[model samples]
Target: MPVVLSLNVARKTIPVDYARAGATGIDKRPVDGPLRVSPTEAKGTAGSGVAGDSIGDWTVHGGEYQAVYGYAREDLDWWQSELDVPLSNGQFGENLTTQGIDHTTALVGEHWRIGSALLEVTGPRIPCRTFAEFLGQRGWVKRFTQQARPGAYFRVLEEGLIGPGDEISVVHRPGHDVTVELCFRALTTEAALLPRLLAAGDSVPPEVVELVHKRSVVELDS
Candidate 1:
């Protein structure tokens, strides 16, 4: 059974050279029990869905579709071995560091029941300059994109509280082959996979859907 390994929340923003805001809430720390999960009051203005978790860059980071970020502990362990550096939970700006779950293979629109909250997988976390800078790794964005294990973001469907050690139950899964990894590849390195993302229906992000439509039109014209 999948379980929450750590419940991380950024206590405050810290200065960073990469972010447009000149500060980032990427330095999240694990916290003890009962964190509230809910929709933000406004998109691109308010912060994270998890109460007390700060979002320094509201313009792109926090919104209805990206309310919470989850990263697999297995992935972190892999990175630790690859980089020869010890990594901790929340190191990658994820609010939930999970265990026993393959987040990349999770289907889009899959429903997870954690504690009393219901969260629906919305999309993948796109690697940004901030992420690269945070990790202090050269070519981190390109490397992460190539790896295609870009974790997963979720939208709060039923507000409730979540905590470390809470069991994560997959209450529902969409009937599609569009896993988070596939969507990431389509949006990043493999434009050829864009058409396949349509099978996921409205569960795919609207921006990605628009890109797919435009690509189809271009192909038709050609």
Candidate 2:
């Protein structure tokens, strides 16, 4: 019985040295909500799926496939112990800080019903310079990539309201072994695993499938 520990939204952008925009909406704060969730108007042009959440970099951050970000509270707790830092909800720029779920192992295309909304897991959150800078950690991107606990990104399947304390139920799961952790590894550290991603079908992002095809050709030529 996974529950939304915190429903977070960034109401405004804040200055940051990492992003091209010179500002970021990664500094999310937990908000009282029954917030509406809907698909972005268009890819790379609109912001977040959550009504009030801001997206600083529209080009890479917000889109149909990455409308909402969910990170498990257990994973954040693990980071807190590893880094000896206090991490509050929304610390990692997640729209939903969840409890009682292991997002790292969640299968791509898995459907979660939260409140009245239905969200389908689309991909993993790739660690960026913005995320590293936000955490003020040295070699954070490489470290995060190596750890491979990248949280899940989701698309709004059925638009509705979501709020803190809402229970999250897995309503559907695609027939595949491609978990978020596997997808992250294939895209980042382990290129050898790219072939394995084929079984995931269209459940994975198109960019990932394209990369897999390109890499396969490169390997064959070599």
Candidate 3:
């Protein structure tokens, strides 16, 4: 079972006042950093990326040790040692930082328990131009899209307070036959496979599953 060994939220919101931000429509953004947590129920915005009321909740796949999100993994000095770019911190804007989990293989509808906090798997990370502004790179959105390992965004099935060093684990993984990556693609491109993916028709998120149905080129008998 994957579980979180540690979690974190901004000790203080970092500053990201890009000088060219106005030109890019990306300025005065608060960069969340060091969001270590002790594990607790997710309580806050639904789709707004702000975990807690201030931010949002995050979950790991299965219940493996802990889960890791945000730019920490890609930007931290330790991780930077492994990368050529040596990225900066506060890129993920995550409410929770976790360890020991393979989020990519995590299927949708998975539920997790961190300390007393319970979260339900809702969807995948939505890419946009805003993220690219931070990297000063074009196609950053497409790069993430190609990777298809975007972490999961969870909804608070239950609510509670959490701090640093909480044990997080999957409470349940609804026996769905779909992987997180496939879920992402269905929402973006290659939506044609949704029917074959869902197999259950309307069970999956309509925004995702039905998006394909709406665009489906396959002829259906009336």
Candidate 4:
């Protein structure tokens, strides 16, 4: 079973001097004990799980489609060697630092039951300026894009208490080829795969679907 290695949250703090300094909710710290996990009631607000885990910019971050972000411990370990930097849980601002899960191959509509809440994999996290500034890495966005290991975002389906060490398991997987990595590729490197995202339905947020369609139209017209 996949398990949560750490549950993270952060207090809203003063911004530091960086591209993301003005960003409101990028910092997160690991938390222990039981945390509530539930859907966000509005955009830009903390979602149900782990109270006080805030999103700096709700317009772009928190929402039903992006209520909780999960990054695999294996991915973090890989980055540790690549960057030669000390990495820790919540380093990526992910709500759940998970273990024993292949996030790259996670299907967009796959479901996971952790503690009492059920979560649906929504899509791959798109790296942003805030994320880049938080890491303070040079050429960070491009490097991250090239890695193509962006973590997965999830929507809470069932509200419940969750904590570190809770068992995580796939409860359902939509019969579609739209894995998180593939979805990320379709949006970033492989515009030709845009049409394929249509197969994902709600798993791919409607805004993304529209963007893909617009891009596809531009490609055909060009």
> Would you estimate the TM-scores of all the predictions?
0.95, 0.95, 0.63, 0.92
Pull out the clashing pairs in model 1.
none
Q: Give the residue spans of candidate 1 off by over 4 A.
A: none
Comparing 1 with 4 on lDDT, the higher-scoring candidate is 1
The CA lDDT at 218 in model 3 is: 57
Clashing pairs in 2: none
Q: Model 3 compared with the native: what TM-score? A: 0.63
Displacement of residue 14 (Cα, Å) in model 1 is 1.3
Residues 54-83 of candidate 4 have per-residue lDDT tens digits of 665566777888888899999999999999
Best by lDDT: 1
Best-to-worst TM-score order:
2, 1, 4, 3
Residues 1-222 of candidate 1: C-alpha lDDT, one tens digit per residue: 999999999989998777999999999999996899997654576789999999889988877888999999999999999889999999999999999999999999999999999999988999999999999999999999988889999989999999999999999988889999988998898999999988877666666788999999999999
